[model samples]
Target: MNALPNIVDSETGQGLPRYDLRVENHGPSDLEFEIWQIPYNGTPDVKKPLRISGLRGRNLALIEHRVLRLLAKAGIHLGGLNIQDQARYALNEDQALNLGLLFRTLAPMRNRENMPMVADGIEAMGKEEAAYWLGMAMHRKYPRRVLMALRFLLIDPKARMKD
Candidate 1:
């Protein structure tokens, strides 16, 4: 099979990806399956969407893996502090809102590369929100490692950067 020629722009020296297009005249059968690189204005950003579309699943996994590691490390470190009873405290509505907001703000920055930002997000929360997160750690529904991490974050947010 013949490869499509590289289509490029004359002015900006930009290039477009090649495509294999086949067209045939069924009645006369004069034309057969073929492809080409035509010089025309095409969607330059078309490949951009294609590149990003396949990244969602992989990116989610990356984020989740990073979060798990981060939380696990936090939990281990906090265990050193030796707060066995792990008392819970009442949370303010505003603090809850702030905690949600913090997650909202960090969701986009998820990934191993953006680990530093995670700590920054935690620190951005007011003391009230941090305290609320500490309470969340006491709940059985939350993963033990992540729960410990949250508790440690409330106590020492700086540990986030260490990851």
Candidate 2:
């Protein structure tokens, strides 16, 4: 078994779904990412952690664009958020931290280049949504693996069943 590089551990006590992300570079063009979701209430099972893998960088970007377009079409007034030159929308300290961690985990190679502009688009995406898009992107090539990821995301046992 091979180990991944830059495996970021999740922060506890945030009451948010913890994200454990691992990014491994197989080559100049090939990369693999594994995201483990640690529910706030329980310990993550290491051996059976729900994994979303094989999402190409291009695909992830595509999903990001689609999401932005959809939001725009919905009349959300995202003008300030779409500013290309600078960060017109201020992210408080915590969102800034989340953005940095997510950007590094998702696109480590491009982390230093035009980060503020790129963050303009994805800064609104919560961690779980980012993970979901990543899983959907992987589903483009590997369908079966994404099923487990879907089940994990869609079914929250703690939520009470509606009548």
Candidate 1 colliding pairs = none
Each prediction's total of clashing residue pairs, residues at least 3 apart in sequence or on different chains, is 0, 0
lDDT of 2 by residue, 13-95 (tens): 23333444434444453333334443333334433544433244653453445433533453423343221222222222233
Q: Deviation in angstroms for 144 in model 2?
A: 14
lDDT of each: 0.38, 0.40
C-alpha lDDT of candidate 1 relative to the true structure: 0.38
Which residue ranges in model 1 land beyond 4 Å of their true spot?
Answer: 1-111, 144-163
- CA lDDT of 95 in candidate 2? 36
Report how far residue 5 has shifted in candidate 1, in Å.
79
Instruction: Report the C-alpha displacement of residue 72, candidate 2, in angstroms.
Output: 28
